[model samples]
Target: MSQPPKTQHASIPEPLAHPETRGIELIQATQRHGRARDLFPVWAAPNVSVLNFTVGASLILLGLELWQAFVVIIIGSLPWILTGIVATSGPAAGTSGSVITRAIYGIRGNRVVVAFFGWFISAVFLALNWLASSFMGAELLGQFGFTDPVLAPVLVTIVVAAVTVLVAVFGHGLILRSYPAVASVLLAIFLLVTAFVLPHAQWGYVAPEPLEGAPLWSAMTIGFAILASTPLSYTNSPDLARYLPESTKPSRIIAATALGGALPCIFFTAAGALMATGIDAVAMDLGIESALLALLPAWLGPIFVVGVIINTIALNGMTTYTASMAFQSIGVPIRRIPSAVVVGAIGTALTIYLVMSTSLLDAVNLMLQLLVLISGPTMAVFATDVILRRNRYSGAELFDEDPGSPFWYNGGWHVPGLLAVVLGAASASLFLTNPAWTGPIAAAMGLVDLSVPVSLLVTAGIYIALTRLAAKRRPGVLPAVENAAA
Candidate 1:
């Protein structure tokens, strides 16, 4: 039972009947005038300056790297940079589970897997990040002699969630709008902070050897781990890209996104590695230590600490906010739940639990491990659907709940994509000689650590090959409306 063709209707209503056009509304008009039929008309425009993504992501990732192995994060992202290219240039046929089930598995069978893949991770990451922020806030602020540090941490979570919710509920336009400007400022402060620690960095403390074995793997893992943030950053991109003047080149968007992820990452890794060479305090251990006091005036330490906290919170906020949007996108086109409220409540809850067990350092490591495992295939699936299929989706028919629509629900399981991701993650995990995988692998013994770059490629290749084979056997399997013939 094939799905019906899409209606002529646009997802959102077209511009109201006024001769005059506003800024973005004007861009929508130009798109409607036959500029690009595929545009989805999201509120956030897709284009971002290279500086915006690089600085922001760099600050976040590097701060993380210094805590773990500075060396590992650098090595991990080496392959991730190439991987990012394969992602930003492409699009998914529909939100998660919807497109994969149709292409590989039959509509009904893969539904559970699709839903699990989509919601489980989105929910978990949102919960974890909220906790990480609140926990850090409680501990960092504890020095001020506040009574009940435990309860205070909960309030920090509330504040984080509230701010993020406000941003998300209003729509993600704020993120796209502020990324470039805010990124620049963040970068400048980051550099200033690093400069303060220049004298403290005893390069001699860094190993003369390139730090072999699992340590090497650990460093790479750190880089790969941070990839969790990439998809969240990009999930809202279609909204951003749709508004890009129809005349703007897609190549620019790809370049900017790639640069945005890569350059800052490298800078952060290098800088943090330098700091790692110098630090010693067990509590202040993650490189930004008392040395900072000697490096800068005493007053600046608190100011920088606050900045670091805010920067980290902002990055965490972005992740939490986007994760919520992704969850809502799957749940309801018009989710009644407010994003701010969700962020506040969830963030607070996560904060209390986080304080009980993990350190900021540990959470960063966990985030990378989980992110890469999911990210590799997520990007692969999206890229194959968009670039390989070309831009052809039935806006209204896709939303139809009918089982026949490839987009309605995927087959019971998308074996190709699943296998690909499995194979890819397995390869990275299997091939690695690192210490970290011991915990993840021991926990999910049969499961592959899909976060590795090796997993990403394996998954993508298998899925692509499988799709081609299916095409050869049954030419009619593809949706007539999508015309996804690359």
Candidate 2:
């Protein structure tokens, strides 16, 4: 049973109701009572579609065995390489991560930091991918004696972003339609090329010694880092989930969805591992290029490079789509930029900048580190709240904006939120080796002096105690507050 609410404030406005602005209704549900009915669907096609785009391209990056990539792949990625899959039994949205922050730090448990920072990270990723794809595309043509790389990358990025934006704006059906055609052909090419190049690979370097100090752990971390986007992958799941007719088992949906996305990691890592040993890693930075040079005669390399370009485009489209969602999550409030236009334009700009900047490698590392650091405590709290607190997410109250809700911390920002976040940030800054924001996150974690798993434990414990104390005190003070309100 729910308690009668305190009087609603006259100042606050309801969420804007615009037909044009849509939610990630990727799940099938209707607005009934207080709770939204539709659980996010774990669909197969969208999952696979995203997988083909994301994992397929990721394998291509595996070709660039930069830093510890090779060591990570060889040691901990045994299962992934064998199957090329990254399954998802965990929470989808960075929701877990988001919850941790809300429960502990930020606006009395109203932590929108996940959405805020995640959008930035995803935006940067989109930019990087667009930059890489466009730059690489231009280079492919330039290598053969085309023209200027600068103009080509920039122009091409704009064009590609434009196309991607169109799809995102129109509908999901259009995006799904292209997946089979593009992913199937690319998968075939990737396989056929791998089949041919297998013989050419230098068998001697297949398994280099494990990373210098902690090979297994480092390897697993690297492998896991590659799938860093896994939790955030729920952005689109909402779209696909919306269609499952509400009766579908979300857990089953998640399993199947993860399976589709994960399958490519096996072959992709394998392809990367095999090539890392066989060819100069940099020279084979482009998988198809390596496969072409290794297996096919020299002349055919260009043709397949074109296919790689297509594959890149398909995935870039997904990147563009996700980027738009991230932007819309923020941009809608500030102004009224169309999600499509925002995604495409910003994507193009960021991509070109990152691709040209050479510092992008640093950028990527920083992004991943932040995601992990933030995700740790976040997932913990969310999981606990879902399983322990409400049984199954009975309700969520954005208490920061609307203090009348049941969960409201009732003031500006809660003390626990500020303290927990500071601690987490400090710990992350100290422990994590990556630069930029990573150091701060490690520092954040260090401030708390808890391992991610343990820090999560500590964070949850602290918050639970804090919330209970608040609840116990609330009833005693209500009469006075009510009298004051009257």
Give per-residue CA lDDT, model 2, range 434-472, as digits (tens): 434334443443322123444355555655555455545
What's the TM-score of every candidate structure? 0.70, 0.65
Please provide, for model 1 over 178-211, each residue's C-alpha lDDT reduced to its tens digit, 9 standing for 90 to 100: 5445566556666676677666666555343454
By TM-score, who's the top model here?
Answer: 1
Candidate 2, backbone clash total = 47
Query: For each candidate, what is the lDDT?
Result: 0.45, 0.43
**Segments in model 2 whose C-alpha atoms lie over 4 Å from true places:** 1-21, 24-115, 176-182, 206-240, 281-316, 319-337, 359-367, 374-402, 412-422, 435-486
